[model samples]
Target: MKKIVALVTLAILIFSCSNKKQGNMLVQGQIKGLKKGTLYLQKMNDTVLVSIDSVKLLGDDTFLLSDNVKDPVMYYLTFDGNTTEKRIMFFGEEGTITINDKIEQFGFNPEVTGSKNQDIIKEFKKIDARFKNQRLDFIKQDFEARKVNDEDKIKQLEDDYKRMMRKRFLFTAQFAKNNADTEAAPYLALTELFDANVRLLDTINNSLTPKVKASDYGKRLQKFINEVKANETK
Candidate 1:
């Protein structure tokens, strides 16, 4: 009887180990103050957001999740599969990543590490925030000028706004060029240069390294450029 019980225990242990998911990327994190909840690791599949891995916490704030990452791409850490809000976005690649954040601020700002692509994005956002502020200033000035019926001020603001936009485009293009070897370069082009001039888009795309040009964002950027050029010819 004892032998049969031991055999059963061994079989259960083997079954549990086999059921555990193993992947190239490992994401482990701690959510302070989170005592009980479900955490989901998701990514965009074509256009749909799909959950690749998930963990439910009962009494601990720490969790571990992973996925088989083929290429570096943006992944979302959401609570209870909620993709609409409070989702922490990060670039995931082959390797272990660590994330730490408080439950209250959840997705507002999380310390993410272990991915070079993510570091590049963080650096870009710092400078991009300044441009965003300038844009808001221009919008406010335009609104006030319109309120006073100041046609001259409105025209001047319009010209200034156009110049600012041009400056921003150039900055983004140069930034992408500087990081041409990284996947972030193509990603920036796809997201930031969509409405930019075709020439600028082409410049960034051309600057991409062969490896980056083969990445997911790189392929998408190439396809987008092709579509734009095709439309221009029509």
Candidate 2:
């Protein structure tokens, strides 16, 4: 009889394990303060989990992230790349769970729903994309002028180039402040932008702007310096 009981217990354990889901999370919600943008659902452990197995987000204020969890773990919401004040998710139950919370992240009335933070992140992403697009066009044009060895025009680019970078730095700083209560998405975005644009601007100023290189590239660099400076004064 003991042997039979042991066999039954083993079978039950096996059955339960088999039924457990591997990718089993459905997080969804709406962020009322947003009009448009990309949002992220990033998980965190020792390091920030920017990328996850399931990439689920949409423009209609909905999202789903799936993963198996025997124990409850913490997840984050990335609104507009601001990660510090992210929405936290806890999965301690089996079936389905829901949550609703309003954040003072963006404004006094910014809200999140369904235990997920898809709403705020998406809206922020939209704004970030627009800002990037505006900057990219100028970057491309500045590069194009240099490709043909137009040494004269390089001086013109620098006036506001560095200043623009500083602006981006400042803008990202603001972003960091708005999302100050939760995860780390805003910080991550600010870090990346600082590297890509601000640091690059500094490098250009230090390495390429001065000493009057007088080459096509140099002319472009000068132009950026002038632009950055002019913008700064304004």
Candidate 3:
């Protein structure tokens, strides 16, 4: 009778372990210089940011969170500390992901791994930064022109700024068209070029693959375009 009970307990243990390993994603992270706090794994459900998992860090700053991921989506790691709250956003995909960062600069810079989508996001940001820098330079020149009360120079700079903005918008549209197979395509259109002309938006939307157009962001892009058209008719 005792041998029979032991066999049943062993089987249950094996099954529990197997279930854990079958989860779609495993996020393991460690924060340096963190003595006590709570780490929350969060995702946006519609408009609300909901916590999916959390761990209390007493003496150790390491944590592991796992969940079943249906698609590549955005996830946030939020740290509730004694004096400050920090949050970091990343693209979460299937398989194991690792994050390492310091408590002081929690969200500013962190080493993240295990998602191809995140890598693509990083590349996009680099290109976007160049446009931002150019805009800032124009703003500085405009400021100088105003100080000198040079109306002609200011007008020329204003025209230059508008031309530069148009060029940036075209680049973003091209990027989205080229990467229509990836989630980043719709995301860029929605976030970066939502204020752009409807024709440009339509160009990107039409270029998307059927599979991509069926994704969450893809549906959002379609809805946004519809709303834009409605407003135009109004």
Candidate 4:
């Protein structure tokens, strides 16, 4: 009787531990060439970034962190290496995520995996980079025109810059509209298009499905739109 009771107790404990691990988000990463430092896992609560877990490294560059994540959301990985602090953002989901990078390029060039939203963000960023590069080219042309004291050229460059900005806004609106069922839709609006024209923002908001509207980011987007409209009326 004692042996049977002990076996049952051990089985229950193993099952409980397995369930706990499977129910939470696991982030395991390695920072190569890092001899000493602290890595922090952080998330935003309203307006503040709060640390949820931290690991101090002495000789090993590897660390693991886990947290209960109810939905896909943004999280930050911050490293303090006694010299400088570096931070990078990623979307955290309920599964194992792997990150690997050198300490020198921790935030700049880390290989991250396991979140679908992060993949979407990567695609959007490529489009955004092209727009930014075009804006920079316009700025350079404007400077050249100013040096030559050519009013007509300067005016043309200014008009081009304005058109580029309008195009960027339209691209963001279309991206959100086409991805309304994904979290990326609301995220793009909240981060990139909050200051966009109210009419355009409304069109993106209307494109979201009922389920997407109830998500955390979706709710925040709705609140932001309301605030922008209120400010316009004021």
Candidate 5:
């Protein structure tokens, strides 16, 4: 009976080891102050978010999740399958990526590392925030001008707004073209320049490196450009 029990235990261990998840990319992180929760590593699958791997924490805050990354793409780290809120979004690629955040803050601000695309995104956000503030200021000015019925002021504000928008669009297109070798190039063009002229979008798309053009975001950018062009012809 003792020998049989030992054999059964060994078999269970072997089975568990064999079933362990292995992949090219590893996402490991620690959520400080978290005692218990479930962490899920998710990615988009044909417009649907799907979990690739998950870990349940019983008395610890450390977690490990991984997936077979074919190309650099955006990924989400969420708790308890609740991706709708308090989720950390990062660019995922081959190799190990480390993310560290406080459970109290969660996704508000996470320190993500090991992805070059993410670095570019961080850089762009800083400048983009300035543009956002300027836009808000313009909105307030426009509202005041219209309230006072100042036609000359309103017309000047309108012209200024148009120029600001043009500047923003040109900045975005140039930024994308500057980093055409990275997957983030197409992503930026798709997200930031989507409403811009088709010519600007085409310029950014045509500047993408071959490797980047083959990435997930690259394909999406191309498809979006085609759709816009088709609409113009209609």
Candidate 6:
């Protein structure tokens, strides 16, 4: 009887171990167009993309990615084979990765069939937007801190950013909402400083001194402005 019990226990252990494997599924599909003709499904904010995993693309545009996904995580579909575009992050589901449109739409398209986890995905998107603004405010704050020469205050602001960046999208966005006014002050100050900097830059751009005419400093200032404008989100 004891030997039979041991065999049963061993079988259960083997089955449990198999079920507890490291990964979940990743469903991939390509709607319209071709070339590489592949799209990637991956967990959001995660480093590596699962290439060797089993992903299915069906005739009706439904797909499944199966691995033992660790937990419910923020995941997005990326078209990295051609260009750098990431679909919105949604709470991952093993059921399906749906794409309605035949071709990829780089920007957010509300009508597009997204993850099986619809509500969670929408919430993730909302938080993502809010977090973006929160960080933008931080940029402005940086300029202000420098202009006022407030080293201590700058450190505090920097520390806050450090802490915030460590959090997930939802938490960070919620935190931003709660401390909206308090957080925005630094960014506003920075924006003012950047404006002043730009003014100085403009005034000096058209007229170069004997020393200025000798080098590319004027052009460099203009380049800096252009770069900043390009990178600044909204």
lDDT of every predicted structure (CA atoms):
0.92, 0.48, 0.85, 0.84, 0.91, 0.47
Off by over 4 Å in 5: 1-19
Give the lDDT ranking, best first.
1, 5, 3, 4, 2, 6
Give the per-residue lDDT of model 4 (tens digit) for 1-234. 999999998798657645654338888989899889888888889888888777667688988777888767898888862213577788887889888888777788778898877878888998899998998899899899999999999999888888888999999999889888878788998899877788888898999988778888888889988998898899
Per-model TM-score versus the true fold: 0.92, 0.39, 0.85, 0.85, 0.89, 0.37
Q: What is the lDDT of residue 103 in candidate 5?
A: 91
Residue 116 CA displacement from its true place in model 1, Å: 0.3
Model 2, poorest ten-residue lDDT window? 181-190
On residues 1-234, what C-alpha lDDT tens digit does candidate 3 reach at each position? 999999998788557645654458888989998889888888879988888776667688887777778767788988872223578788887899998999999988888898777877888888989899999999999999999999999999999999999999999999889888887788889988999998999999999999779887889999999999999999
Clash count list over all predictions: 0, 46, 0, 0, 0, 18
* TM-score for predicted model 2 compared with the true structure: 0.39
Off by over 4 Å in 2: 1-18, 21-117, 189-234
Q: How far out, in Å, is residue 188 in model 6?
A: 28
Clashes of 6: 18
Off by over 4 Å in 4: 1-23, 81-85
lDDT of 2 by residue, 1-234 (tens): 999999998798668645645565555555544445545556665465663433323334543444554333345555665666564544222334343333334322334343322443545566677668757866886798789866666556565566666776656545534543323222223234434444444443344323223432234444655666577779
Q: Write the per-residue lDDT of candidate 6 for residues 1-234, one digit (tens) a residue.
A: 999999998798658645644444444444454234344555533356444332323233433344555333445555543224545334454454455444555435623343443553354457667667878998899889989999998998899887656553235334323322231212222222244334333334333344332333233445665666676646
lDDT, candidate 1, 140-197, per-residue tens = 9999999999999999999999999999999999999999999999899888889999
> What's model 5's lDDT at 217?
95
In candidate 3, list every pair of residues with a backbone clash.
Answer: none
Model 3, position 144: C-alpha lDDT score: 98
Give the 10-residue window scoring lowest on summed lDDT in candidate 3: 80-89
Better of 3 and 5 by lDDT: 5
Q: Which 10 successive residues of model 4 have the least lDDT summed?
A: 14-23
Ranking by TM-score: 1, 5, 4, 3, 2, 6
